[model samples]
Target: MTHLHRAFLFLGTFSSLVLSAAVSHGQSCANSDQVPLTKVKLEEIASAVGIGTNDVELRFEDFALETVRPGLPIPHNNRFFFSADRRAKAGIANVVPDGVIPLITITAIPLKTFIHSNSVFYESKAVRRTRLPPSYQKYQILGFLDALEHSPAGSEGSFVPAIVFMTTSDVKAISKKTRLLATVQGVGILHTIACEIPDVLPTENNLQMGAAIVVNPEVYILNISFPFPSPPGSPGRVRP
Candidate 1:
């Protein structure tokens, strides 16, 4: 029962706990084939959890248990863009326009939801912040192509408006400095599209920015193909 021996015992126990927790997290997130979140689920979670509302507080102390269930359907009408391998590449082809793409292997407690832990404890007014969790604070990872300088056909704009949950890690991992002629599958043909760095929009916070793209007025996207790297035989297109 020496003091040094006791200290060593405590450290060993702590390390064991940490390692176990990490392994459990990895197992949950490894289910990459989990069902994508759908518009219905998005609305359900938003309503159940009060996402996009003034009440920007954690509904529970532990997000891992109370957070929206992992593997919920990702919302529809979201598309991801990537840097083109060829400068002359004009469009992405042969994609399931009405299909869903699972970009992130979502876990019960997203890394951001845990890392941005202040939101769980502080009031929005107290922190002088606006956007709330389950939506703004906790977002799915998305691929953003930094190269495309697309704007409204006649007007040159730097950013476009998009709707989805994106993480900072996703942004850093996918954004390539090269640009390309981006496009989405239209009703009868592939319509040219442009990807832009989103600027701040007038949300409740008025300081939130996102990754977005431009589309032709005639073309409405029913679904999008997010080009995140996936394991072989996984659903959704992995190539542009």
Candidate 2:
């Protein structure tokens, strides 16, 4: 067989294996209803993957899968801030105190994944010189990758944090930006919540009220209601 043909076979096998590992069926995801953003609700689903299902869910890798799950509506999963580091510990701040920022649909991968896959190009001095966070900072997707900026309460134009969803494309289109677009098909959320960070690092356990970057913007989305979302000023606990 040709070298190119052999490479394609390897890629296909690798993709299948990785996807299977990412997707785990949970007990309650059977319904299409927007999963509530509440801690109890999310933990129940996170439990399906054996993440230890604490009162607070801190598994950012597994958390990313939830954001992309077929059964979850874009708005549903966009509820809380997730971090691969978990040290920032922004896991339980559901729906931001400012309340649902926005939702944007774009095809995208984790920034860490995108970087590592292209590490061949950036592996040398380039990786060292680049300002990008390390691969362990998986919650990031590069600053302003979403091409979106949201208005705040009255007059501020703070780029509100958003919940973003990745959709499949049957055909690919090429873009010519060639400099900083995350991907032609990729989309990412920009807020302290997802990376393109909001500088919530100094906050009390990285809770919603502490997210000063987009602090208390007028409600943007999640117009549909859910039961017992975290209220402002009360971040609850980061972990149980």
Candidate 3:
């Protein structure tokens, strides 16, 4: 089958899977209010990734979860709110708490430095893209957030916050090769860039961001760096 044909088939199958699960296991917003956001566990995230509870773990700086209320569409204003790192850890705490269980959306930063340091592991591209079952698309906003609290000081790079809209088209584009594509200032004047993931090499020392790799619709690879130098008189150009 051609790529487009395969993509359509994949979408149909994926939709069925998502719909089936939603009908059987889906919880309502009222249910969300019963379980505190702070009480979310690894199992919840695992479910989000379409993995069994045994397949996932709660690690520092791993996946981020955002709670979206029912009847509300994600990206309501071209932006979404995520729990602070502290709140996230609290929800995953062992102690159960009585409170609203906010509908959870997951996110992560695929930082080159972190990947190079071996602090984070990348999931397979196929698994990342198809695992979630796209029915969650409306309720979930999958993308990366620019580091606002921890960004470098006085860096030339703009630090606007932004999110990526993942689609089949995006996944196919990144799956071919690795290279930086484009950079621009997004929300909050933050700098963002997209790159294609390179084929893995045995001798390679570091895994970089910016290079795209398909890792679920909601997961994003982030490139945090200073803007490139512009020509002598172009706009936003700076002289050394």
Top candidate, metric lDDT: 2
- Model 1 lDDT-worst window of ten: 117-126
List where candidate 2 sits over 4 angstroms from the true fold.
25-144, 147-240
lDDT of 1 by residue, 194-213 (tens): 11112322122111112112
Worst 10 residues of 3 by lDDT: 231-240
Best by TM-score: 2
Error of 2 at 184 (Å): 3.1
Off-target runs (Cα >4 Å) in candidate 3 are 1-136, 142-159, 163-170, 173-240
What is the C-alpha local distance difference test score of candidate 1?
A: 0.22
Candidate 1 regions exceeding 4 Å error are 27-240
Q: List model 2 lDDT by residue over 21-96, tens digit each.
A: 2222111122233221333433443354454744233343223333322344122223233222322332322122
Could you estimate the TM-score for every candidate? Answer: 0.20, 0.21, 0.19
lDDT of 3 by residue, 77-169 (tens): 222224243234333212111111111112234433211111111122111333222112221211111222122321223232222221111
